[model samples]
Target chain A: MNKDYLNSDIKFNKEVFKTPENYFDNVKEQIYAKTIENKDGQMQSRVALWTIVKPQLSLVASFAIIFFIALFVIDKTKEITPILGTADTSSYIYTIEEGFLKTNFIDFIDPSDSSNYREEIPQDQLAEYIKDNIDIITIALLD
Target chain B: MTDRDIIDGLMNNGNRDHLFRLIVDKFSERLYWHVRKMVVYHEDANDILQNTFIKAWRSLDSFRGESGLYTWLYRIATNESLTFLKRDKIKTFFSFTDSYKNVEDRLNADPYFSGDETQKLLYKAILSLPPKQRAVFKMRYFDDMKYEEISEVLNTSVGALKASYHHAYQKIQKIIEDSV
Candidate 1:
C-alpha cells in the first residue's frame, strides 16, 4: 500500500499547530477590545467606508470632469456658431440685398437707363432725408 | 449560541456590540486556524484573524445572509490570508536566497511549532507550493473543507479547485519524496 501521507499516523496532523496557553481567550479579548475601541472611535468604520467609496467617488469625479469639459466645449461652439432653427432668412436676405443694391447696384445699371433714373430731388427734401438718416449713414460709414 | 442568534443580535441596533462579542467568541479560533495553516506563523495568523473580524464587523451591514456565517467568515479569512501571502512573497522575493531551506528553518524555529522532523518536512513541502495552491490543498486536506464550500469561499469553480488540489498534492508528494 502507498504510504498514507496525510494520515495522523504521520504525526503531521493539525495537532502539530499550537498556540500559547490562553491564546484563544486572549485573542478573543483582544478582538472584542479592538472592536469596542472601533465602536467608540468609529474611525475604522469611516476608513472602511472611505475605501469602499473611494473608487466610486473617483468614477463620479471623472464623469463630472468629462461632463464639464463637454459643457465647456459646447458653450465655446455656441459662442462661435450662428443661431439654428426656423430663422426667416428670406427677409434677412432681402434686407441685406436691398442695402447692397442701394450702395453698389448703380454700377450694374445701363448708362442709358441710369440717365432716366436720375430724378431730381428738391434740395430741402434731400436735406430732410439726410438729417433723418444721418446717424445710420454715419454708423455704416464707420463700420 | 447559534449563528442565527448571532445574526439576529448583529441585526438588532440595541445590542450590536454584545452580538459582535458573540461573533468574536464564535468565529475567531476557526478563522485563526484557517489563517494559521496558510501563513504557518501564529503572529501573522493572529494579525490576519483580527483584520478579518474587524473587516467583518465593518461590513456587517452588507451581509445578506446568502451564505452561512461561517462560510462568509471563512471567505474573508481566506482572502486576508491570500493578500498577506502575496505581500509577503513580494517583500521576500528579492531577499529569499535559500528558498525551501528558509521555510524549514523558519518552521523549526517557531516556538509554537512542535512538529517532528517529518512534520517539518511536510510543512516545508507544503509551503513550497504557490500561495493559492497551498491554500486550496490546506483547506481540502487539513480543514476537510468541501469543494463546494471552498468554491464559495474562493469564488473559484469546484472543478478548478479540484484540479488545483490534485496538482498541489502531487507537487508536495514529489517534494517530500525528493527531500527524504
Candidate 2:
C-alpha cells in the first residue's frame, strides 16, 4: 500500500565510522613476523618428555622382570626335574623315607617359592603307606 | 574477479584490491540489510561489516578452505552481530523501560520497518518470543536465508530452525486472525 508508514515514523542513530586501517597493517606485520620465526634454522627440537619416562621406566621394569624371568626361564630350561621318578634316581625313595619320619626331604628347595613344603610325596607310596600304617593313624588318634 | 578469486589472491598474498572491492560491491548491500534487520540500525551494521572484513582479512591465513570463503566470512559476521546484540541487551537492561524506548524510537523513524495494524499485533506476538526464536525468525524471514546456512551460522539443527520458523509464522497468523 502507498499508505505505508512515514520516514518520520523511525529514527536510526548513526554510529561514528572510523577507519581501522592500522589494525590490518599491524596484523599483517605480525603474521609476517610469525612466518619468519617459523623459518629460522635453529633446528628447533623439544626434548621428548614421554620418550624418556616411558621407555626408561619400561626398560628398567621390563628388564628387571626379564632378568628375574631370564634367570627363571634359563633356570627353567636347565631344570633337571630333580630326576624324581627316573630309574637311577633315589630321590623318590628319599622322599618316601623322609615322609615316613615326617621330615621334608626337599627342605633346601626354593624358599622363594610360596610354600615351605616343596616335596611332592609319591602317590603310590603314599597310598601304600596309608594302607599299611593304619596303626600309625590309630597311634596319632590315641595320642 | 569474484569473491572466490579475491579470497584466493588475498590468502596467497597477491594483489587483491579488485577482489576485496568486488566483495564490498556485491555483498555489502545484502549484508547491510541482514545486519540492519537484526540490529535495526545502519551504524551498527556498518561497524559489523567493517569488523567482519578485518577478521576475514586477518584469518585468511588459516582459512583452511573448509567451507566457501564467503560462508566462512558470513559465519564470523553473524557471530559478531549476535555478540553485539547480547552486549547491547546488557546495556539496555540497566533500565527495562529504556529497552522498549529504543525500539519505540526505531519504529518512529524507519519506514521500511512498517507493519500494518495486523503487523503491529504481529510485532507484539513476535516480541513475546524468546530471543533465540526471535533471531531465527528474523534471519529466516527478513534475510531470506536458507535453513542450511542458518544452521551453519547458529550451530542449530535445520529441523530446529524450521520448527522455530513454523512456530513463529503460526503465532503471527494466529495473532493477526485474533486482531480481526
Candidate 3:
C-alpha cells in the first residue's frame, strides 16, 4: 500500500465493482414506473376548471345583486309624490315644467313677470287665468 | 440520439415520455456508478439515482440547455448523493462514534461490493476525505471527469476543484501508505 504502488495499482483496476444482474434494465423500468406514478399524481392534483371559475362567477353574481339593489333604491327615492289633500296647481305645474325644461334645454328663461312668480296659486285664480287667457287661442284660431 | 435530439423530444408533447425513457436508459448506469462511488452502497445509490432522474424529469421543461444534458444530470446526481451523505452524516453523528466507520462497516458488509483487499483499502482511503473533496476525487479519478465539468456539477471553480482533488489525493495516499 505504498503511495506510488497504490497509484500504479489504481491504473490497473479500471472497474472494480459489481451490481445486481440486469440492474440497468430493471432500474430503467423502475424509474419509468415511478415517473408515471408521479405524473398521474400531478394530473390528479391539478385545479379543475370549475374550481377556478366558481369564485369568479360568485363575484359577478354578487356585483349584479348589488347593482340591482342600488337601482331599486335610487328609483324609489326619485319617485315624486303630491302633497295630500291639497290642489297645489302652481307647485305641481312648476315641478313638471322644471323636469321638461331640464330634459329639453340647456338654459331656461322664465317669461312670467317676477312679481307674479307665486309658489302657490289658488284653483280659482288658475281657472280665471285660463278663462281670461284668450289671446293665445284667438291667435291660433286666426292662423 | 444526440443530447439536442433528446431535449427536443422531451420538449415535444407526444415524445416527452419516450425521450425521458431514452434518457433513463442511456444515462442511468453512468449516474448509478457516480452515485454508488459516493455513497458506497447499492441501495443508497439506487435511491439517489432514482431521485436524480425523477428530479430531472420534473424539471426537464426548465432545463433551457444551460449546460449539457448529461452535465445537468450529473449535477443532480452529485447533489442527491451529497445530500444523502449529509443526512447520513447527521444520523451517524447522533448514533455512532465515527461517521466514516459506519461507511466502512457498510462497505465491508455490502453484498454488492466485491472489491479485493486493495480496492477496499482504496475506497476506504477515498471515503476518509471530507464529502466534498471525496466527490472531487471520485469525479476526477474514477469518472475521469475534467475539473471544468466537476466545477459545473459542484459549482466550484476549476482551480478550487483541482486544489480539492489534490488535497484528497494526498490524504488518500497518506492513508493508504500508513495502512501498508
Candidate 4:
C-alpha cells in the first residue's frame, strides 16, 4: 500500500507565506488612498446637502424678519405725540374769565413752574375747569 | 478604528482604512494561497484576490456582526475559490481538450511542482474526487483548519466535513495503490 502524501519530492508550501520586499508599504498606502477617497466623498455630499436645503430655509427666515420690522414700526408710531407728553403752562392757566375756566388739551406742553398746580382747586373740580377752558380755546381757534 | 468598527464603517460607506489594512496585511498572502491552491496559477490567484476584496467592500453593508469578521471574510474568499473551481470543472468537463491539460502544461512549467511518481499519483487521485470533496480535502489537509473552523468557513457541519475529508483521503490511498 503506497501512502502517497506530501512526497519528499513535493516542492511547494513547506513554509508560511512571506511578504516580498516593498509590498507591505504598497499595501498600507493603498489602504490610505482608499480611505481619503471615501472621506472626500462624504465632505462633498455634506456640502451638496447643505446647498440644496439652505434656500428653502431662507424663505421662512425672511418672513420672520419682516414680522419683527412691522412690530417695531407700530411701536414707533405710538411713541411721539403732543397729547401724550407733559402739559404746557404757557398754553394753560387757572383763569376765571366771565365765569369760564379755559385750558388747552391738544397743544398742552410741560412746565417747570410750580405755580401751575395750585392747592386752591380740588382735583375733582380741576377736570371740570380744564374741560371748560378747552371749549373756550376751541372757539378761539375756530374764530 | 477597532476591527469591528472599521469593518462596520467600511460596509456602511464609512472609513475602512484601518480594518481594510488589517484585512490586507493579515489575509492577503493566505487568501492568495487559498485561491492559488484551486486555480494553481499566480495570475489567477491575483485576479481572484482582488475580486474577493471588491466583493467584500460592496457587500459589507449587509454584514450583521453575527460572525467574526475574519471568518466572514474567509467565508467569502472560500466560496469564491470554490465557485471558480466549479466553473473551471464544468468547462473542462464539457470541452474534450480538457482544462486540466492547460493546468498540466502550466504546472509542468512551475519549478516548484515536483515530477515524482508518488506526487503524480497523489495529484491524479485528488483529481478523481468531485469538486466539493476536493475542497474539503484541501481545506482540511493543506490549510489544516479544524472541523469547527472549516464548518464556520464552509457553512458545513463538522460531521459532514469530517466525512468528506475521510472519504477523500481513502480515495487517494486507493488511487495510489492502484497506480503502484
Candidate 5:
C-alpha cells in the first residue's frame, strides 16, 4: 500500500535492505580464524608438494639434456662422414686410375712413334704396367 | 588506521594476522552491501564477502599497492559476485527452474529484505539486467560510486560504463512504467 507502487518513478532507496544483527562482527572473527588456519595448511602443503615433485622434475630435465646432446653428436658425425658405399668407392678409384693412365702414361709416349704407342691402353695392360713400374708395397703404404 | 599503515603491518610476517583484522573491520560492511545488492540474498552476500577477504589474504604477496586498497578489494568482491551469479544461473538452468522466479520468491520470503512492494519491484527490474549492467547500475545509483572508480573495479572504459548505466536506467524505467 505504498504510494510509490502507484507512481511511475520508483526512487532508488538502499535503506530498504537489512542485515542480521552483529553479522559484520561475526563475519570478521570468522574470516580471521579461517585465514590463519588456511595459511598454515597452505604452507604445509606447499612444502610437501615441492618435496614430492623436485626430484622427479630434476630427473626429467636431466633426461632431456642428455637426449639433446646425443642428437647433436649424431648430427655432427653425419656431417663429417662420406656417403659413398664400398662398391661406389672402388668405382671412383678406377675412374681416377684411368685418368692417370691417359694423361701420364699414354701421353708421355712419343706421339711421333705412333706404332710403339697406341691411342688407348686396355685396363688389364694398364694394371700390369702399373704393377711392374710402381712398387705395390709403396703404393699401398701411400694410400 | 590508514591503508599505508595496514599494508606496512601486513608486509611484516609477525603483524599480518592483527593487521588483517583491522582490514576486516574496515571493509567487511561496505563490501557486504555491494555484494548483497547484486545477489539480493544476505547469505549469498555473506559467502561472497568472506570469499573476497580470504582471496585477498591468499594473494597479499601480489598486491603491490598500485591501486587503492579499497579499489582492489572492490574488484575482488565484484568478480566473486559475478562468478556466483553465472554459476547459479547455470544451476537453475539445469534444474529446469526459472532463476527470476526463484529470486522473487526469496526476496518476498527473506526477513532481511525489508523493502515494500515498490522496492521489491525495483529490485526485480534491476535483476532483469545482465550481470555487468546490474553491477554498473548498483554501483552508480545506490553506492554513488564515481564512473572512474567503477571503471577501475570493472576494468571497463568510462564511456562504455556510462552508456551501460544509461541503458540500464531506461530499461528499469520502462519496466516500472509497464507494471504501473
Candidate 6:
C-alpha cells in the first residue's frame, strides 16, 4: 500500500453527513423540558416535614382536648352535693316519704357507732349490678 | 461572549441558564461533527451530543478555570462518544455480532451520507483503526486540531497522541491502498 497514493487519491469531507431539518433548533428546548420535568417530579415526590407532623400534632391535640373535657366533667360531678333538703309529702302518697326517709336515715346511720351490723351483698350480685350499670356516663367518669 | 464571560455567567446564579444556552449554541455544532465522525450516524450523534451537554450541565459547578471551556466541552463530548461506542460494542458482543460490520452497514445505508466513493473508502479505512486511535486520527487529520489540544481533550500526553495518530495514519493509508 502506497501512503502517497492513498493520501492523494482519497479526500475526507466532514460535510458529507446531514441531519433532519431544524434538528439543532429543538435540542436545547428538549433538554430544558427534560430538566424541568425531572425537577417537577422531584418536587411532587418530596415529603414535607409539616405534612407528616401535622397529622400527629392534630392527634395529640385531640387527646389533650378529650383529657381536659374529662377533667372538667369529673370536677363538676365532684362539686355536686347529694340532694338532702326536706320535701313536702302532703300531696304525694308514697310507701316511703322523702322527709321521713331522710330523717330516719340520718338517725339510723351513725358514723361513730362501730357496733352497728349491716348485711353485705354477695360478690356475684355486686358484679352483676356493676355490669348492668356499665354505660357511657360510667365510662366517661371512669376515664 | 468569551469563555471567561460564559464561565462567570455560569457562576452567577441569575445568568446561568442564559449563559448555558449560549454555551450550547456555540459548541453544539462543533461537538456534533466531532461525535458524528466517530459514530457515523446522525441519530446516534444527536444522542451523544445530548448526553454530552447534559453531563456538562450537571457538572458545570465543578468546572474550575484550570482548562479552557472549549477543551472541557470537547473532553466531555469525546468521552460520551467513546462510552456510546463501548456500550454498542457490548451489545453487539452479547448478540454474537460484529460491531464494525454493523457500523459499516450503517455507513453504507445511511441516507445522509453524501460522500463519493473515495470519501466512503477513506471513512471505512479510518473506522478500521481502534477506537482511541480513530479519535486521535480524526482530531489530527480531519478536525485539524493541534496535538496539544487533542492531548487536553483525551487527557493523554502529546507524545503518545502523536504516535497514535502516526500509526492510525499508516494503517488508514494501507487500508485505502488495499481497497483501491
Give lDDT tens digits, candidate 1, residues B1-180: 899877766666537777778778887887888898899888888888888888887887788777778888888889988987776665455443677667777887899888888888888888888888999998898878899978877889999999999999888777766767
Candidate 4 per-residue lDDT, tens place, A98-143, comes to 4555644333434565675555456766686667688886888999
Higher-scoring candidate on DockQ, 4 or 5: 5
lDDT string, candidate 4, B1-180, tens digits: 366775676657764545666666777666767766655545555556656666665565677778777677777777877776676665554445655466556555655444455555555566667778887887777777788887877778889999999999888776666656
Instruction: State candidate 1's DockQ.
Output: 0.19
**RMSD to native, candidate 5:** 14.5
Worst 10 residues of 6 chain B by lDDT: B87-96
Q: Root-mean-square deviation of each candidate, in angstroms?
A: 13.1, 18.3, 19.7, 25.3, 14.5, 20.1
Q: Can you give the lDDT of residue B89 in candidate 3?
A: 57
**TM value for model 5:** 0.63
How much TM-score does chain B earn in each model?
A: 0.94, 0.75, 0.91, 0.79, 0.92, 0.90
Deviating ranges (above 4 Å) for candidate 6: A1-6, A36-143
lDDT, residue B11, model 6: 61
CA displacement after TM-score superposition, residue A42 of candidate 1 (Å): 9.4
Quote each prediction's TM-score. Answer: 0.65, 0.47, 0.64, 0.53, 0.63, 0.63
Whole-model lDDT per candidate: 0.77, 0.59, 0.75, 0.62, 0.78, 0.73
TM-score of chain B of 4: 0.79
State the TM-score for model 6: 0.63
Give every prediction's interface RMSD.
Answer: 6.6, 15.2, 10.8, 13.1, 8.9, 11.5
Question: C-alpha displacement of B162 in model 4, angstroms?
Answer: 2.8
Error (Å) of candidate 2 at residue A55 is: 62
Q: What does the lDDT read for residue B105 in candidate 5?
A: 86
**Order of all candidates by lDDT, from best down to worst?**
5, 1, 3, 6, 4, 2
**List-wise, what DockQ does each model earn?**
0.19, 0.01, 0.16, 0.02, 0.21, 0.13
**Which candidate, 2 or 6, would have the higher lDDT against the true structure?**
6
Better of 4 and 5 by TM-score: 5
lDDT of 2 at B149: 79
Which structure among the candidates has the greatest lDDT?
5
Where model 2 places Cα greater than 4 Å from the true spot, the runs are: A1-143, B16-18, B110-131, B170-180
